[model samples]
Target: MSTEISPESAFPGPRRVFQKLNEKPLRDDLIFYFAIVAVASVLFMMLPLLTGETAEIDGLHLIWFLVAGTLIVLVQGLITGAVALLAVSLVEHFFLLFVDVHREFEQTMKSTVYALSPLILFSWAVLLKIPFAGLLFLAWFCLSTFFGVRIFHEKSKDRAVFVALATGVVLAFYLHRAVGI
Candidate 1:
């Protein structure tokens, strides 16, 4: 489907247009979850800051953090709100499009990802004194990827526990660098 556009797609016929849209083969259910996540992320980022964590924006460093935060929000918001409606879309874009993580774990994965990414992305933004936004995204993506894969692929609770431990290990490395933890 990624490669082969239908014959009817070349023409602007209604059927052709639908066919063309359908050709991409991304799932509708995935799109729905994506929208939900994007909205949630944007809202969370924009919401009034209630804590020193979100409330204060200090010097040039904080300014840079806010800027990167905005970009992270925008990217996440677009993907969640504009890009596609599927959980798979989130997984695809986030996981280097490595594998389709299937529908069963879609909800859990989307929830986990949308919930985690901004905070993790903003870690660099808030901790901008620490490193580039990409490093944060990289760390968060790696942790999220492991967990997302754990959510969808692990066959048993024991495997799930190990997956979580592994995620913690990777996350601890980045966070130690970020927070001196």
Candidate 2:
């Protein structure tokens, strides 16, 4: 038998994750996309608690706030993530048009969502109030997106780098305005 390794059998890592995700059926990817968005939303909701934004309130009020706030943030974050995903995919597809590299919109969406794994998984560091934490995660997200675009779209390094940076800047601006960071 040939020794070729499929993406599904690759060792676990960011690269493997991206590869396997890119090859997954669209339905599976959508499920994973929502799962990641939900988890990231929960972590985002924890920010206020972790940063002591609710510390002044007493017991019952704090409990009420936590419960209500979590529900609101989760719903809001999921909606926002879905909208942003569509917008970003459209933007990236438009960008690819200029490069004469046509790809399906779903492919772009898959790349975008899978690339977000880094940010969704580890962006909680921002709540720690550590210096440059946001930037670090932003860089990670950008790098992952760069590779994803390259591998998924079969783009050259230059095109992938350009698209990744363009999208990364937009994402950074959005996060800065939304999160007040």
- After superposition on all C-alphas, the RMSD of every candidate to the true structure, in Å, is 15.1, 4.3
Residue pairs with clashing backbones, model 2: none
Clash count in backbone of candidate 1? 6
**lDDT digits (tens) for residues 1-181 of candidate 2:** 9999976567676656667677787788778888888888888888776766756888899789888988998899789878877887777767777767777877888887776765666667765666787887778777877877887888998998888888778778878843345
Cα lDDT of all candidates, in order? 0.48, 0.77
Q: What lDDT does model 1 reach?
A: 0.48
Misplaced by over 4 Å in model 2 are 1-16, 51-64, 173-181
- Our tally of clashes for model 2 stands at 0
Q: Can you write out model 1's per-residue Cα lDDT over 1-181, one digit (the tens) per residue?
A: 3888766555565333323333333355345545556656655565545333464567898778777876798687766444322433343434323333344444444434443545533543544354456455545554554444444453244443444444445555645665444
Best lDDT among the predictions, by candidate number = 2
Model 1 residue 21 CA deviation (Å) reads: 25
User: 38 in model 2: Cα distance from truth in Å?
Assistant: 1.6
